[model samples]
Target: MQKLKSKANAKANANVKNSAITTNKRLYTERQKSHFLVHSVACLGTEVHLAACPLEFNKGNSSTGACEDGMPAVVSCVAGPLYTHNVALKKKLKVSKNVRLKGGTHTAEGRVEVMRGGKWGTVCDDRWNLQSASVVCRELGFGSAKEALTGARMGQGVGPIHMNEVQCTGQERSIWSCHYKNITEEDCMHTEDASVRCNTPYMGYEKTVRIGGGRSRYEGRVEVLQALPNGTQRWGLLCGDGWSTKEAMVVCRQLGLGYANHGLKETWYWDSSNVTDMVWSGVKCTGSEMSLTQCQRHKVFNCQKAVARFSAGVICSETASDLVLNATLVQQSVYIEDRPLHMLYCAAEEDCLSKTAAQANWPYGHRRLLRFSSQIHNVGRADFRPKLGRHSWVWHACHGHYHSMDIFTHYDILSVNGTKMAEGHKASFCLEDSECQEGISKRYECANFGEQGITVGCWDLYRHDIDCQWIDITDVKPGNYILQVVINPNQEVSEMDYTNNAMKCSCKYDGHRIWVHNCHIGDAFSDEVERKFEKYPGQFNNQIMN
Candidate 1:
C-alpha cells in the first residue's frame, strides 16, 4: 500500500514539471518577425514587423493572419526604406512612377507589371497612400526599402491593366491593391509635393500685403499665402484707381487646398508682380466679398475719414464684408440763384410751405414748384426794405389811427387769450403773443371805446365730435402738432378784409359746401408758430381746414 502511494506522488511531480516547460515556451517564443531595408537602412524584429501591419486590420483573429480561406494579407510600409520578401514579390506589387521604389520595376504610362500571372492582369490602385506601403514591406518580413509595389495577380494577366491611379499606402501588399479611382498624380512640383515637415504653424510674422490697395485698377496675378483647414482661401494683390468694371487676373493653385466650406472662407485677391506662385495656401480671410479676380484687398475704408486706405487686416467677420463709410457727406456746391419775385406773396407761400412741410417734410422743407418770375438784378451790396407782404410778425407792426386800427380780423390765431386788443379813436391793435404769453400783453389797453374787445381761444379739433378717439397718452410725445377742422356750411359767415386778415375768421357758405375761405392758416406766418406746436396730438383730416 505504501509503494502505491509513493507512485502517485512521483507521477504528480512529473506532470507539474512538464506543464511549467510548456508555459515557458509559449510566453518566451519570439513574436512574428519582419524585415525592412532602404538602399542603406534596414531593421528586423517583432517590433519592426508586427507594427508594420495595421493592427486595425491584421490581428490574430484575421483570416489573413491565420492563412485561412486563401484571403490575401495587407502589407503596409508607412515610412520609406521599403522592401519585399522575395524578388518575386516585387513583381507582385504596382508602383507610381512619381514615387521611385528603391529596387522595383519602372512604371510606364502609370502602369506597371507586378505578379506572375501568365497574361497581364489589371490591379486596382485605390486608397494607396504612400505611408501605407512603408508598413507593407515591414509586415512582409522584408527589410525596409524606399517605396511599395502593388500590382495584384503578379501583374501578369490578360486584358487592360485597369491601373486605377495608385495611391498606395506602402503598408499595402501592392499599389494595384488599392480601391479608389481618379487618383491625383503627385507631380514632383513644389506645390504638388509640398513637404509637410516644412509647413510651419501661422504665427503672424510674415508681411501680409493685400493684392489691392487705394488704387482701384489691377493688372497682375493674385495669390494666396497660407493653407487653411477648410479649403477656403484668401489672396492679395496690387491695384490702382477706377478699377470698377475692369477684370483682374487671379491665379488659383488648387493643389493642397481642395473643396472647402461654401461661404465660410473670405478671400482677398489682387494683381501684383510680387505674387509669383498662385497657390491658395494660407490666404484665408474673414469678411471679403470680392471673388479672387474681382476682389480688391484695399479700398477707401472710412468714407468720412477722407483717403483712409484699407490695408493688411484680417477679415473681421462675414458681416464686415461691406465696409461702411459712416456718415460720409459730399459737399455739393450750392448755387444760390437770384430768383425773381413772382405774384405769390412770400407770407402766402410760406403758409403753403408750412402745411406741406408739417406732414411730408417737417424736419426738412418740401419744394414742389418754385419758379420765381421777377428777375430782380442783384444790385451789389444794396439795402432795401422787403415788401410788407414778405414781412412776418417778426418785422411788421402798425400803430392804430383815427379811422382805422392795427387789427387782426381774419388772422387765424391758434389762441387769442394771450393776445391784447388796444382800442383807439381809429381802431384796435392785436398784440403779438402766444397763449402762455397772453397775460403780459394787457398793458396795451384798448385805445377806442367803440372798438369791441373780443377774445377767443383756438384749439385743434377734429371734424366731428364723434370722431374724437382716446389713445394712450403715453403714446403721444411732446412735439409740434397740427389740427384740422371742418365748419358746417349752415354755421359760416364771411367778411372782406383781404390784406389784414389773410386767414378766414368765420366760415362762409357758398353752396351746399361751406366755403372755408382761409381757415388753414399755417404756423410759418405767426409769431407764436413754434409755441403753437407744443404737444403732438394726432392726425386729422377735414374738408374746411387743413
Candidate 2:
C-alpha cells in the first residue's frame, strides 16, 4: 500500500512539472513571429537536393542556384497553442467584483468606482478610453462600452480618486485588474470622475413596438407594427384582456426601457391617434422574454371588448421606485374625525370619497373619517417621478400645488373576510421630501413650482389631518374590520416591489370610538404569519350594527 501511494504522488508531481514546462514553452513561443516557411531535403538516387516548398525569396535570388555544397537549408515553423489551434481549449479569465458603476439611469451607464481597503472610490478620467471603459462595463454585466464619458457626465462622485491613466485590453474582468497609476489627491478631482455607457443587445423590436399619443415617452398607448401578407407594415392596437405587467415587461425591454411600472388597460385619454383596429390579442408573457413576439399569443384573434379605448398601454422606467410604508407611524397616528358634507366637495368631485358618499343627501350628512399618517419612503435607486409631464399637471387651487398624477394612494376599509366596505383615494399627491438620511439633502418640494417627486433617500409624509386622507366609513356598520392603505395602488407608476406597497391593520369600530392595532407592512410577514393575521378574530363580537 505504501508503494502504491508513493507511485501516485510521484505521478502527480511529474504531471505538475510537465504543465509548468508546457506553460513556459507557450510563453516563449508567443513572443516569436506569427508565420514562417518550411524547407525539406531528400536524397534522390544518391544525389542530395533541397525539395521545393513555399518560401520567401530574397532579392534576385535563384531558388535552384542558391543551394550549395555544405550549405544547409534552414526551415522555421510557428509554435505555441497555434500549433494545435484546432484542438486548443480557451481558458476562462478570472473575474473580480472590486469594480462598480454608480448614479446612472440604468446599470449600463454610470460613474466608475473601484473597491480598495473595504471602501469604494472613484476612478479618474485621465487617459481613460473605450478599452478601459469596456472592462468596467463587462465587469458590471453589460456588453462593451458605447461611450467613455469624461468630466463627470454622470455627476461628480464622492470619495478618494483611486485610479488614473488606466490602460485595458478590453478583456479584463475588473477595472482594477487593468494597468493604472495610483492617483494622488492633486492628480484628480470629483469633476474628473470617469463614466461609461455600455452597449446592450438590440432586441429588434423597437421599430415593431412603440407607445403613441402620450405626454411622455415612458407613458402612452401601446401600438405594434404588424407585417401584412403583402409585406407592408401597419400599426394597430392590442387587446387588453390578458395584458399584464409580464407582457408589459417585454414591451419595455423591446423599447430599451429598464422595466414596466404599470400595464394600463383603458388609456381613454391617450386615444387621440384614432387607430381603432385591434391586431393582436391574448398575449401572455413570463416577464423574462426578450420581446413580445417571444411570448405566448393566441393564433386566432378573439376580442370580447375590442376598442381603441380598451387597448393596452404601458409606463416604462429605467429604474423602478420602491415605496415602503412607515408601519410604526400608521400605528401611532391612527385617529377618527367627523367631516361635514360641505367640507368634502372637492373630494366628492374628484371621486376620492366612497361610493356610498355619492348617495348622501346634499349638505346633510357627515362622514366618519378613519385617518392615519402615511409616510412613504422611496427606498429605490431612482426617484419616484409622476408619469405625467409638467404641462399636464393640474394646478389645484384648493391644495395650492400642481398635482402630477390623478391618483396616488388608496385607503380602504375592509371586512374581516377581505371585502372592501368603504374606500377613499388621495389624488394628485404633491411629492416632496419630509425627511432624509443624514448626508442626503431634500431635492424636491411642492412650493414655488419646484420639481416634484419623492427623491431617492427621501420620504413623502401625508399627515392624518389632511383632506381626503380618510376612508369614508360612515355607512360601514360597527364591526371587526381591516384598514388597508396601498400606495401606488393601481400601479400607475413602476416600483421595485408591489408586494410591499400595502399596509394593513386590524381595527374595531364601535360606531363612535375606533381602535386600530396590529398595524404592519403587508409583505413583511411570512405566509404563515399572514394567514394567522388574516384569520385572527378581533376583540369585538361578530355582530353587524344596523
Q: Which whole-number lDDT from 0 to 100 does residue 541 have in model 1?
A: 24
Residue range with the least summed lDDT across 10 consecutive positions in model 2: 44-53
Estimated TM-score per prediction? Answer: 0.15, 0.52
Model 1's alpha-carbon lDDT is 0.24
Per-residue lDDT for 1-546 in model 1, tens only? 999999999999999999999865654452232221211212333222344543333334334433233322234342211223356556655433212111111111112223222222233444433354443343333343333334321111112233344444343554346443532233211111110011112223123323332133221223245445799655532222222111111111111111111121112342224443332222322211123422433333222211112112111111100000000010011011211123223322223222322344223332222111100111111111111121232322222222122321111112123221111010112221112113323222224322222112111111111101111111122322222211111111111000111111222222222222222222212233223332211212232222
- lDDT tens digits, residues 1-546, model 2? 999999999999999999999986876666443332332334332111233223443334333443322233334532222112344331232234567666554446777877665446788899988778877866665666788999876644544677898988665657767899997888898768898998765436577888988888987888888899999989988998878776787788778776787787788887469677889999888665556777887898888889888889987777766678887788799888888888888778777777788888979878888888888888665788887777889977765667788789888888878898998888755788989866889998878887788877789999988887778878889888888988887666766556667988888888998888777667544455566667763652222100
Candidate 2 lDDT score relative to the true structure: 0.74
The number of the candidate with the highest TM-score is 2
Q: Tell me which residue pairs clash in candidate 2.
A: 261-494
